[model samples]
Target: MKYRSESILLLACAALASACGGPDGDNSEAPSPEAAEQDAAGPASNDMPDTAPAETGEASGDHEEADDDHAHEAAEGGRLESHEHGHAMLAVTLQDSMLSVSFEAPLSSLGAPEDPQNAEDEARIEAMLEDFRNDETIISLQGDAGCEIVSTSTGTRLVSGHGEMQLDYDFDCENAGGLEGVRFGGFDQYPALLSIEAVFVSDTQQMATELSAASPELKIQ
Candidate 1:
């Protein structure tokens, strides 16, 4: 099912697309997940300003609500919700100790057959799903957070002439406040995926950025 209510990724993408022409980065420095994890045992420092550059610039109040509504509407039945070659979106939400991450991409981007008419196709999709669930694939967290996967679900939908794949993961962290950032590891597995518009939301604020294989971490502050 589409996570319309909980996700602002579509809106983030729309805002970035309008602001930067597309969900593309500006050669900003991406966070190093390895470094963050290495310092996971250090004292928590929540005051560090967000360093991950936002592709959408700053949010203008006048356009926020309208863009959000448009995004939700687009997600319902518009072309924006469908698969786009070489592009995908990742939404990350953190509420208290519960963290939810959802990814949506084109079937072809994940190397899955457009139409799974046989057992081989089904197996291939299942294998892809398995890869997605691996902790080293989609995202990696600060080890000090003590995060563990609580559940996972995968779904597919026909959109236009192609198929779209959705993967959802839920995690419970023992030290939620210690989470410093998330590093995506799927790019190496799917090199054809050109861009991933990633959005992170927490109780205090939200941030958006574009991720690619060359730079794949989203630092939280």
Candidate 2:
């Protein structure tokens, strides 16, 4: 069952750059048939655990505050760059009812084609992009947090033929004040995704944590 789930995720992320032997040799895209099936199975929420809220202490306060400042500075100015293939970075900023999350990963990790020449290849690439921005399933909130995506902006930045893409997702959670836990839904949709170095900033809290396939939850106090 675990293997099955990961397989579904592999299809969901569409990282099969070497297997996409569709018409015209489109190796950097997901096969249409499997992608359609995966789309059908998605949109169903999972039962992820809600961890206890983050802990704060007198000794950790000053250090956590410093880290929080650095996190916000990084997110606001620009994204965190990563050259590693399997590792990605995520930054989340929460203020009042508005929450912003950013996902940055190597384009090669998704098996990006140098350029699409035909309609078929374009469609396949679009499908892969849509899967990457799975929206509701990309990141989820625990309990009745009422976190819903309000806007999304995606783009690619290339430097010397190597590029990375980032997704900026904005959300409005009605119960924003009760923010406690977050789940990286992309984990269940991308098997190749190893770990995400996540930094979160909130009005009264700031924290950094590493999220892995073995543990994909983030506690936001």
Candidate 3:
């Protein structure tokens, strides 16, 4: 009778262990072979490397439409070019507290600069940039508004294809609310810059002024 009871107890314990088994008696679930194989065959992910951004000389402001569709070829005020090298184009636009001034000029008009292939030619360009950087007179704004140049973007290079050179200048101004006038001092620095066709637009007025060596200042109302 004692042997019989011991055998019964052992059988009951085996039955309880089998009933409590939760798929291999472990808490973690095992992955199916099909799911594992699919994960193994998943697509490879390649990380892209960082690259330098392309240069674009876009300024913030509304582009003034050409006064005439054929204005480019037409000369105004007896000048040889209505839109060509010997002259520079200046545009100043104001929106809210932000002020921006954009300047464009022909490379040849800077002087008889040689093609910038050698060190000496490069130095000449560098000198001009230094002058512009130091000149507070280049674009004088009404001082009452406390306007100041915060950032300047300028680029100059020779183009072999058209034998044309270009200089682009963009200045971001802070505290430009009281801006009332501007004076282009390029003529004072580069004698070749005879005149600047300027378009000034602000909250109160839209004006077109031609600044020259003779009359280099525009007073904004």
**Full candidate order by lDDT, most accurate first:** 1, 2, 3
Task: Return the lDDT, model 1, position 67.
Answer: 32
Global lDDT of model 1: 0.56
Q: Which order, best to worst by TM-score?
A: 1, 2, 3
lDDT of predicted model 2:
0.51
Model 3 worst lDDT window (10 residues): 45-54
For candidate 3, write residues 1-221 as lDDT tens digits. 00121222222222233322356554344343223322333344110000000112332221111244354323221111122556666656666665656565555556635356567866775566555545656656654665544545555533321112232333344556556676676676678767766766654445666788889876775
Question: Best by lDDT, which number?
Answer: 1
Report residue 215 deviation for candidate 1 (angstroms).
0.8
Q: Which one wins by lDDT: 2 or 3?
A: 2
Model 3: residues >4 Å from true position, as ranges?
Answer: 1-83, 112-114, 160-177
Residue by residue across 1-221, what tens digits does model 1's lDDT show?
22232234434333223222324544343224222322332344221000111111111111011133544444434333334677777777777788766677877777787667778987886677556554353656644677777766666655333566766667787887888877777787787787776777765557777778987877775
Residue 203, model 1: lDDT of 52
TM-score of 1: 0.62
TM-score of 3: 0.54
